[model samples]
Target: MKLWKSRSGVAAWLVASLVFVSACSGSGGGGKASGGAESPPASSAGSASQEKQSQEAAPADPLGKYDPPIEITTVRIVNDTYKYAEGDTIDNNVWTRSIQEKLGITVKNNWVVSGDAPGGQGEQKMNVSIASGDLPDFIPVNSRQLKQLVEADLLMDLTDVYEQYASPFTKEIMNQDGPNALASATFDGKLMAIPNTGSSMDGTFMIWVRSDWLQKLNLPEPKTMDDVFAISEAFTTRDPDGNGKPDTIGISLNKDLYGGYAGLEGFMNGFHAYPRQWIKDESGQLVFGSIQPEMKQALAKLQEMYKKGEIDREFGVKDQGKAAEFAAAGRVGMHFGQMWNPLWPLVDNKKNDGSAQWQSYPLVSVDDKTAQPRVNLAVGTYYAVLKKANNPEALLKIINLFVETGWGESTTPDNYAEHFTKDGVERHKYIPFQAWPARKNLDIHLHLLEAANTGDKSKLNPEEQDNERQISEYLSGKEGAELGWAYERVFGKDGSFKVVDKYVSDNLILPNEFYGAPTPTMVEKDATLQKMELEVFSKIIMGDPIDNFDKFVSDWKKLGGDAITAEVNEWHASK
Candidate 1:
C-alpha cells in the first residue's frame, strides 16, 4: 500500500513521477541496447590463467586510481548562492578533477537543476528518471522515493558492497546515531541505501537571551519559569534597550508556533509538554502529544503571558523572517531556538549594535523536574545504486574519500583550504553523494574544549586541530577579527555546543518515539489535523476560552485520531 499521496507542490510531482514509472514499466519494450563487439570465448584453462593474472595485476586500494577509467553518471543540484571560478562549470570543477585524479572516476551529469528553485524541480527531475526506468548509476533520494524504488526491485542491495568496501571511518559515521540511522534505509534485513545521518542535537532548543539586557535590568540568570516570566515582563516594560520608549519585546516567536527556531515547542517543553512527537501514555499506547493535558496547561500559561503584553501582539501574523526583525533591530531580548541562533540573527544584531550580547543557556524548567529539550533522529536522505550498475562499490569508495579528506585523521590543513575554501568555492558540492555522523560537530567541539582546557593539542584530530588554531587566533585578538564570530559561538569558552554537552551529560534529552514511515491514516489526515491544531492553539493564546481546548481534543479524536492512534500502535508493536 502507498503510505502517502502527493497533496500539492513537490508531493504532487512525486506522485506524478510514480504513476508515470508504473505506467511505463507496464508497457515494456520501448528502448534498445547497443554495445561494441565482444571477444571470442576462451578455453577453460586460458580463462583460469587470465583470472589469476588479473588478480595479481590489480591489488585492492580503496583510494587508488582505476587502471581503466570508470565513468559514473548522475544529476546535480546547484545552489543559487554558489559562484564558480573564472571558467569553472558545475560539471568541471576542483572536486570533479580531484575525483578523476585520486580515484580515476569521471562524473557525468545527465541533467542539472537549481536547488533553490521554488517547486523542488531537482526532486521532480529525479522522479521523472525513476519513472522512465532511466535512472543514473547512483542517486540520492528521500525515504519515500527510496521505498518506491526498493518496492519496484530497481535498486541494488548494498549490504555486501558496504561491508566489504566501506572504510572504518565511514562505518563509524553511519553508526554514530545507533542502528536507527541505518535501520531507516534497511529493508527485509538488508541495507539498500547509504543513510545520511544528521546531528540529533541540532533540534534541541536553548534559550538565547541578551546578557546585556539581563545585566541592565539587574536580574539574575533565569533558572525557573517564574524567573523567565519576571524577566520577560521587565524586558518588555523596563526599557532594557535604554531607549526612552518602551519598544523592546520580551521574546520573539513566529506564526508556525513549533519549529527549531522562533517557536513555542521548546517553551512548552519547559511545562513537560511535547507537541509534534509520538509519546506513550499510561495505557502503553502510542498517541500524539499535541492534545495532552500538559499542552493545555502550557497554552494557559502562554495566554497569560500574551495578555500581559510579554509576547508579540501580532505574532500570529509574523513569519520567522518578519519576527526576526525585532531581534535584528535589538528590540527583542529572548528567544527559544536551536544552537545555530548565534550564528545568524544574533550575529546580525552584533554587527548592528556592538553592545548587544547574546548567550545560550539550557531551557528553564517550569517546576523542580528538569526540563529536557526534544530532539528527533534526522536521517532523511539516502544514496542508492542501480541494480544493473557494473561497479556499485565505487560509491563506497567515494564516501571513504569524502570522510577521510573532510573529517578523518588523514585530512591536511593545506589540502582542505585549497580545495574547500579557496576563492569561496564549495568543493563538497561537486561530490555527487556524501554522508556524515550525526554528532560529528559536537564531537569536534568536545575535542576542542578538551584541548583548550588541557593546554595540549596532541589528542586533537586534524579537523579539530585546524578549528582550534582558528579559534585560538580569534581569542587572542589576531588580525582576522571578523573570523572569530562563528568560532566564539560554536567552540569558544561559552560556545553553544557546550550547552549541548551539558544536555548530553545530564541525560536531559527527550526523543520522538515514532521514527518510521508515516502511517496510512497519518498520510491522509495529518495535514488537516495540523491545521486545526495550529488554529486552536493560536486562538487559545489569543485569549479564547480555555474550554475550547477540551472541545478540540474531542473533535480531534472524532476526526481520524482514533484510527491514527491504532496505526501508530500497530507500528510500535511490530518494532
Candidate 2:
C-alpha cells in the first residue's frame, strides 16, 4: 500500500503485494549482508531454451511437492557469529528439513566453511573445487568463479528451468532491483546461474567524518575537494584529540584501497576517479576506471596529502581492521566508507572515547561536477547446477519454496519464526537458495522514517517494530544508548537512509557499466591486473612519482589489459 521511489526502489508497485519487504539493507564495509532483502521483481516465463534433464522429477510447480524426493549437494559459507538452537545444524536444520519435507529435496552439504567474507575459507575451498572440477550438485559461487565455470563448460543452462519452474514471486524477487542480476549471470544469452542478488545502490559510499573533531577545530564540512584537504590538515595539525602531541592522522586508510571501512573509494570518487569500476566514456564505450587519466589526478591528490603528513604513513601496510584501531584510539578524524561502518570500527570509537561523535556526509567533488559514488553489480553469490547433474529443475523448485516460505502466502508467523529465525538464530542460512529484493531495506528505512514523523506504527512488522524500539531508545537517551547509536545513525531522522534518498534524488550513484560475468581475458588476467593496480596506487599515494601512474596505465594495457578491454567492449556491444 506504499510507493517509494529511489535508485533501487521498486520499479513496479504490482510486485509489492503480500510481502514484508524488510531485512539486511545496509551494504556495510565488509560482509555486506545481502544489502538486506525483502521480495523480488516480476518474473519472466520464457527463455531461449528449457532442457529436461531430471532423473525423477514431475512438471514444475510453484510449490509442487516431489513424490520420491532428490538429494542435491552444495557448499556453504558461514561466519563465527551464526547461532543455532540445540539439535539444529547447517545440514539437519528447519530449512533443510523444509526442503525435504515440502519439496522432497534432500539438501546436502559437501563442504561447509566458517567465514563468509571475501578471501575467507569459503572462497579458498571454492577455488580448490574449481581447480579440481569437483563442485557439488548445487553450487554457490561468485561472479569471477561463475565465469570460470562457464568457460570450463561445467554449469547447467537454467534458462528454461528458471523461466518455467520459478514462481511469480521468485521471479520478481530475483529481478527486483533490475535486469542486471539476471543479465550478469547470462552467458551468451543463456541464464547459466541464479544470481543471489543484493542492492548495488545500498553499497554507495560516503565520507564518515568525526563531527567532534570538526567542531573542535572550527572547520567547515567538506563541500568541495579543497574542504576535504583543509579538514584533513586541520585534524592532523590542530591536536583535535586535545592531547597536543601531533599523534593524530588527518585521514585513515587500509592496506587494501577498496575496503568498506577506512577505504579510499570515496576519496577517489571526490576526484571523479572511480577506481575498480568500469564506467562509460564520453562516446558510450566501456572503459576501466583505474586506467583513466582522472585516476592520476586522484593519485596526485593522495600523494600531496601523504607528503603533508595528513595521511597515515602506515596505511600502506595496514588492513581495514588495523586502520580502524587509529579511530578507536582517537588518532584519526576522517575516512570514507559504506553506511554500515558505524556498526563496526566506528562503533568502537563511541565506546572507547565518549566525545567521539561521527556522522556521514555525502562525498564532495573536487570540482563543480558532482562526485557520484560508484558500486559494482551487487549480486554477491550465484547458485548454479552442474550440467552433469540429474536434477536441474529441482534447484529451481527449492528456490521457489524458499521464496514462498519467506514472502508468499506460506509466510505465516510460524513460518517466519521457526523456518526463518527463532531465538536469534539465522535458520534461513541453512536454506540452499537465499535471496530477496534489493528494495527491502530501503522500504524498511521509509517505513521507519514515516513512523518517526506520524507516530503511526501500524504499517511496521515485528522486525521493523523491534528496530523502531531500538532507534527510539537511542533517540530518547535511554540506558544502553551507545548500543543503539548504530541503529540511530542508520534509521533515525537525518540517518544514512536519508542520505541514500538524496543520492537517488540527485541521481548521483554511478553503477559500473560492466555487469555481466567476467570476460574470458578477465578470467585469465584480472587477478594480476588488480594486484598491479593496488601496488602501483599504493606507491603513488606513498609519495611515488606521479608520472609512475602513466607508466602503470601503459603497462596495464600491455599486460592483457588491452585484451580484457576488447573482450569487455565485445560483451557490451553484443548486449
lDDT of 1 by residue, 263-382 (tens): 888899899899988888898887788889999999998898889888999999977667777888998999888766655556668778867888888898899989888777677568
TM-score, per-candidate, Cα-based? 0.84, 0.84
Off by over 4 Å in 1: 1-61, 116-119, 456-483
Question: Clashing residue pairs in candidate 1, if any?
Answer: none
* Tens-digit per-residue lDDT, 299-391, candidate 2: 898899998899888888777777878988888999988766665667778888877888889989988888888877777889987877766
Best by lDDT: 2
Model 2 lowest lDDT segment of ten: 27-36
lDDT of 1: 0.71
As a whole number from 0 to 100, the lDDT of residue 144 in candidate 2 is 85
- All candidates: CA RMSD in angstroms? 9.8, 7.7
What are the lDDT scores of the predictions, listed in order? 0.71, 0.74
